[model samples]
Target: MTDPISIVSTAMAEDTLRINTIGNNVSNVSSVGFKAQTLSSKGDVHSDLINNSDGRLLRTNRKLDLALQGTGFFVVDNNGQQLLSRNGSFSVNESGQLVTSNGKFLVQGRSGPINVGIDSFSIDSKGVIWVGDREVDRLLIKQPNDSMLLATAGNYSSASSREVKDGYVVYQGALESSNVDVAGEMVQLMAAQKHFSLMQRYFLLYDGLMKNGINQIGKSK
Candidate 1:
């Protein structure tokens, strides 16, 4: 027989994880180019697995900022390692190189980071950088179909391999808003709370049943 306390504890832990996800979504509601992360809860084993996908775009007319119209990610150097992001909140670095808000260098092509040679430039739908007369570099873009695509920090990779769209469009002068909705999160919070309460009631009933069983045994004795 399952222990009543153990069952309750496990249920509570899962509920707590769900609440944490809701909280994170609410917190990043205003983050630029921030995609909403989802918590996938099945039977019990993979309780709080998170899924990160690109969100819908919001138009903010600002130069230096960019957003992808379809399946593509902005390449960035998070310190030394490269990272991918849908957040097009980019700006010129101190060296006048195009970079993310956190100063990560944007990746290009199949080799390394793309160099924005000029002091100013523009990007087209095909992600070709136009610095006056020269096409500097094409942005590195990828599209994955299944669980093989592992999102590390913000970069994605897979063993089976995913195809990349080297010429995807990039909208200059705009930033994508987070896909999170406060109202939706609130609804989710209520549902999770009600379910947790129901589980708690079930746990209490099981405990009472075990106690009554012991009492009946004692009386028979």
Candidate 2:
């Protein structure tokens, strides 16, 4: 049989990891385009764990900000490389080109970069970026599978299918809010703290038992 110390140790470690994840999610609640990461059991057996989940989309109506309804990401040019993001709090650069909140260029149709020079633009239902009366460019929307995107695009090599118009469209002047649930995270934090305290007590009791057993053997010998 596995010893109590070993069993409880594993439980405590897993619980700690879960606690950390919950705290991170709670902290990033106000972060725009923040996706909530999750921890789940991979199998019925203990120690089989997985950490990843798709977060729900939140809509915020703010002009120049765009949000995807479902199953897509807006492509942004971070430095010279393209990156995927859902955060749509955008701003007009000095040169009048549309850029992300952090000043990264929003990729145009995946063919080349877009330059909306001193022009107002509106995204159409088909992800078209119309600058005034002329159609300037189209946005690249992709549905990532297998893995989530990193902060940069150069190292992101996930094989994802391009998201077409399957109920996914650009909502101008709106940003996607972080999917973290504060109430849920608080509940998990409480549970994890309780488990951690219980584990500490158990560990202390197990150590005392071993010490007592060793003393008894010494006296017997």
Candidate 3:
């Protein structure tokens, strides 16, 4: 059988990780396209993170803002690396190429990186970019077959080679709100903290009992 101390220590460690993940979720409640993560344990390991819920769409009324109405991610090119994201708040760079709001990455299109070149354009529901009456390019959207393959970083995510074409509608002038429920996360955080405290108290009690037993044996000798 596993030692009592080892069992309690493992449970305490799990509680600590749970509290941290809940805190992170609460902090990102207002973040755009942020997904709420939950910790799951597999066998004796307690570090499996999963996020599969979709957030609510918020209307920003800003022309460059975009939101996905279904399961999909807009592909962005950072240097040569492709990153998937749902935060569609974009801006044009000096070269007239559409990029993220921070101008760090270029938005990918069907043909490649799209350059509007100082021309006014609009994105339609089907992810098609239109300049006046001319069709420029279609946005490249993809989704992984297994959401577990995605590794999230802020509003962006990445997968190795499991991404496939996804059919999701795009809404211009909108953004996806974070899926985190602050109140629920706070409740979970408090519970995890209480569990950790209880485990610590049990550890102290066990240590004290062991010390008493050792002292009694010494006295007898």
Report the number of the highest-lDDT candidate: 3
Sliding window of 10 residues with minimal summed lDDT for model 2: 44-53
What is the clash tally of candidate 1?
A: 2
Q: Write the per-residue lDDT of candidate 2 for residues 1-221, one digit (tens) a residue.
A: 87889888888887888888787677778877676666665543332121223345455556576776666777676566656677777777787767776675655464566567776668876678887888877777776665654454211324454655465767776666776778887987999999999998999999999999999999999
Query: Which pairs clash in model 3?
Result: none
After superposing all C-alphas onto the true structure, candidate 1 shows an RMSD in angstroms of 3.5
Q: What would you estimate as the lDDT of candidate 1?
A: 0.67
Q: Cα lDDT for residue 11, model 2?
A: 83
Local distance difference test scores for all models: 0.67, 0.68, 0.80
Query: Distance from true position, residue 194, model 1, in Å?
Result: 0.3
Instruction: Estimate the Cα RMSD of every predicted model relative to the unseen true structure.
Output: 3.5, 4.0, 2.1
TM-score of each: 0.78, 0.81, 0.90
Candidate 1 residue-wise lDDT at 164: 68
Give model 3's clash tally: 0
